[model samples]
Target: MTAFEATFEHEARPISRPLRIALLGYRSDPFVGGQGIYLKFLSKALVELGHQVDVLSGPPYPDLDPRVGLIRIPSLDLFACDSHVKALRWRHLRSYSDTFEWCSMLTGGFSEPYTFSRRVAKYLRSSAKPYDLVHDNQSLGYGLLTLQRRGIPVVTTIHHPIHRDRQLALDAAPNWKFRLLVRRWHSFLRMQEKVVSQLTNVVTVSEQSRQDISGAFGICQSRIDLIHNGIDTQTFTPNSEVAVDPWQLITTASADQPLKGLRFLLQALAQLRPDFPQLKLLVVGKLQPSGTTARLIDKLELASAVRFVSGISTEALVEHYNRSAIAISPSLYEGFGLPAGEAMACGCAVISSDGGALPEVVGDAGMLVPAGDSGQLANGIATLLRDPELRKELGLRGRARVVERFSWQRAAIQFSNYYYRVIANADG
Candidate 1:
């Protein structure tokens, strides 16, 4: 049985009454990454379930549903600014959080999670209103302890142990200097580890993530709740009108990120060029000019065969998926594999790496190759390319699986049940 199916067997009883919930996100913009997408969809789904949801988020705010309220918790947002050193002001000195954020960014450390949590904790303490629960999206900072001490119920979702990303980046760094910078940037993991270990309730997106979180944070596997993320079938459905391009393959990844495994995909693309010269890749991410992926593209001479686009709307992204013959996810590791699930929802034949929780998401619906293996990825792509009927069959199956097993409504129901249990235990 699938993880979702197993979870359903021991499902907690759902709360009869609507909950007043607060979802916390440090940086919640859909374009920023999956955390934002998680907040956006999860809030929308919870609202549909008749819950009054308020998203308390830091800068780069999420695009949320009209039913859900947004409580802005402003931060330095130094990364958005062109020059972090110049962005600080005398006014910043008034607030320790702001000062710390500014100084941390200047020194190549990410302090958003810690600072955002501080701001959020202060907001909650001062506000007259009380929430039934506060659900935090991976911002596992020390401030959560303050909430716990105040008799507030809090559940944290750690998408995956970010130590995986840190390790992958350190491995990919060209020199000791670069590796040192990577370590500095991910220094927040120390705080996260401490926070997670002390928190009463913690959750993750997949079983793979649960295992990884347990190992990375030294937490017990049984303590972590597993909730599979959902795909928006209504928005990402198959477009029958759009003609699929036979030569087009699409993938969504941060082009320069070592964990995204764009390099392996590019190498696979290079290997298939001689057999299928017309094959081209469409990347749904920004291209960093000086990044390793850019250099690899030049080295492999696949620039002409590859294209990158970013800052696209959901409608545009769905259209791109429809236009493509196949979607590929070559990530070295993924917590939940949103790209692969989105592709499946769009009825696109998918080829994904067996990275982290990708197999849990893709299952038998799509082709799976070992992560970071160019030869296997190329072979999988070539097989799909040569067999149109197989691609069509996989596309239909993928769509069916998503519609059946993955939906925001189902996820919200599961969340509500989990919330009910957390609150009951706290009260008891």
Candidate 2:
């Protein structure tokens, strides 16, 4: 049976009142990654639909909507501090969870998801007022089943398997030490994988991700709900006043990760350098000064042609999208390619690699290149640049696609309906 086809003792009834929702996240710093962006927009969208939403998050909290209550689920937050070792206090050593968090970081492990889930389970166990449903933002910790066992209806969104990242990182690792460290850091996957098999109500953003979750975690497809995330077109809309730079290109990527396919984009840039010397590339991500991406940039001698920006406001991001001649998404894989959609929403001509659900988002609105193919990427960008009329056509069509297919209002309605299904299944 599909997610909605499940029957419950509650007879799988539709909800009549506003839902009491608790959205959980281990970490949600927008500048850090896309999870923050997901948390921020999803909560806002739910509240706009008349749902009562409270975001429960760990340190490096997300920038949330005013109507969404923020419940701080504090952690050691070692990642934020200048030094993970120095961040630990004497009192922190007394608490096993805090000490585990600190020591795990010190040993190159990520303990936040497992640790945060423990805290949430403990807190909700004592909560006098119960929520209708708990929505987990890819945290997949054992505590989800803990909540379910305690009569709490839990719904979890697994964007993609971190195992993909771990394997890719190992392939990109410079040596055995780094590869071992990457494996150690992602040890929390053991818990996540186990949690996926045990949970009955699960949601995923794309069919690609749903299949991936099924394969990677040994779970059945029937339990996974497919709900596409919405684009905030209001903020990501086209600004006619922002003039495009004919020779400029833009992409949002995790610069240090091999999964983002940034290396291939850089290679494409290098291939086009001789003919398009005036071409400039703008990346909306932090380039770690001492990381692999920075080294590649120096090796490619692209410092002059490329620029990196981070911590910018949404307005600025949309401005960059508006000004770019073409926006490219070269991800090796994605649960859902949000940057491509956001760029499309801003009326930016997009050229996305056939990575994961990118084709689902781009459709016929923009160009599609083979993932990790620098030659194809270069050809696509050069083709768009040589034809301004074609570029303009693609940009207009792209925005129209976003308007027709994706919106937060629509997503909220879908999620609210799924929440009821999960609640009903739990009630059964």
Candidate 3:
């Protein structure tokens, strides 16, 4: 067993009653990203475990289980507006959080995490309701420190550090001007760095993330707890009724994001087209008209071979996975690789890059390729395409792995034990 598992086994204890838990997220719309998904599922799981769970969030609030309460914390939500400058009003100037958010957007800095924390801290301090614990979904802002200082038990979940994202963005910048803009937009990392160093009781989604969080934030490895994220196996299960498309491949990615490594996948798709003229890619994400991925698609002359879809429902996503012969997760790095796990749960033959924590999720059930290598991605895709028996075998094994290892019910139980430990330590 791993050192973390050993430690958890020794210290874990059962709580006598359900917990009044508060989950915090700066912005939580599942369509926005993984954080929203994390909040949505985790909250639902906790409620299933008979805990009173409430999600405190900013604009683009999460679509949560009806049993879980949502306390909305308003922000400027400048990104939703066509023009940040025009979005600001005289009333926004009245609140410091609003003013800071507006000004930060004007200067190309992201202040949502910092501002969200401030709003949450104020709300918690003024409200009479008592929470056994405040779980932060990676805001990592100074306001978390404020709650800790106020004698509140705070457990922050650092789902891989934003430091990794910043460095990757810097590496992908086309020019000095773009590099400068990238640095400016990620300025919140400074606050995150400071806050993480001071906070006690921190946790992460995977072992890779536990190590990365330590390296990126200068924390000790033993200080962070690990709880692997789960897939809703019931929702993502394979549909034997849906016929698989042998020539089609599917992937989920934010097409324009450098960290997602969609460019490499596109390159691989281009390489395979000559050999497999019928091969096509279905990307489950929006295609930005002027983004890097769009330009790459044009240059590769693979526009007709690719299709992009966004804002899809869970049932639709599962159906897509069921219909595809293979699912590929080409991310350069992932905290827990939810898409990969979900695909595995759906019984797709997965071709995943050996990126951060992806190997941990894919395990021996699927094919692995070196991250960011288009040549190897193409080879892996070709191998899966040509071998129908292998695809069927891998699909069954992938589904079994997800069912046996990753489930929200199991995750919720582990988290319940972890929560009691934190509350006990705080009480002592």
Clashes of 3: 0
Per-residue lDDT value at 174 in model 3: 90
- Models 1 onward score TM values of 0.97, 0.96, 0.97
Write one digit per residue (lDDT tens) for candidate 2, span 252-305. 987898999999999999999999999999999989999888999999999999
Backbone clash numbers for all candidates listed: 0, 1, 0
Order the candidate numbers by lDDT, best to worst: 1, 3, 2
lDDT of each: 0.93, 0.89, 0.92
Task: Tell me which residue pairs clash in candidate 1.
Answer: none
Clashes of 1: 0
Candidate 3 off by > 4 Å: 1-4, 7-15
Q: RMSDs, each prediction?
A: 1.8, 2.9, 1.6
Q: What is the per-residue lDDT of model 3 for residues 1-428, given as tens digits with 9 covering 90 to 100?
A: 34546645543444458999999999999988888988999999899889999999998999999999999999988889999999989998889999999999999999999999999999999999899999999999899999999989999898898877888899999999999999999999989999999998888999899889989989888888888888998789989999999998999999988889999999999999999999999999999999899999999999999999999998899999999999999999999999999989999999999989999999999999999999999999999899999999999999999998888877788889888878888999
Model 1 per-residue lDDT tens digits across residues 183-208:
99999999998899899998889989
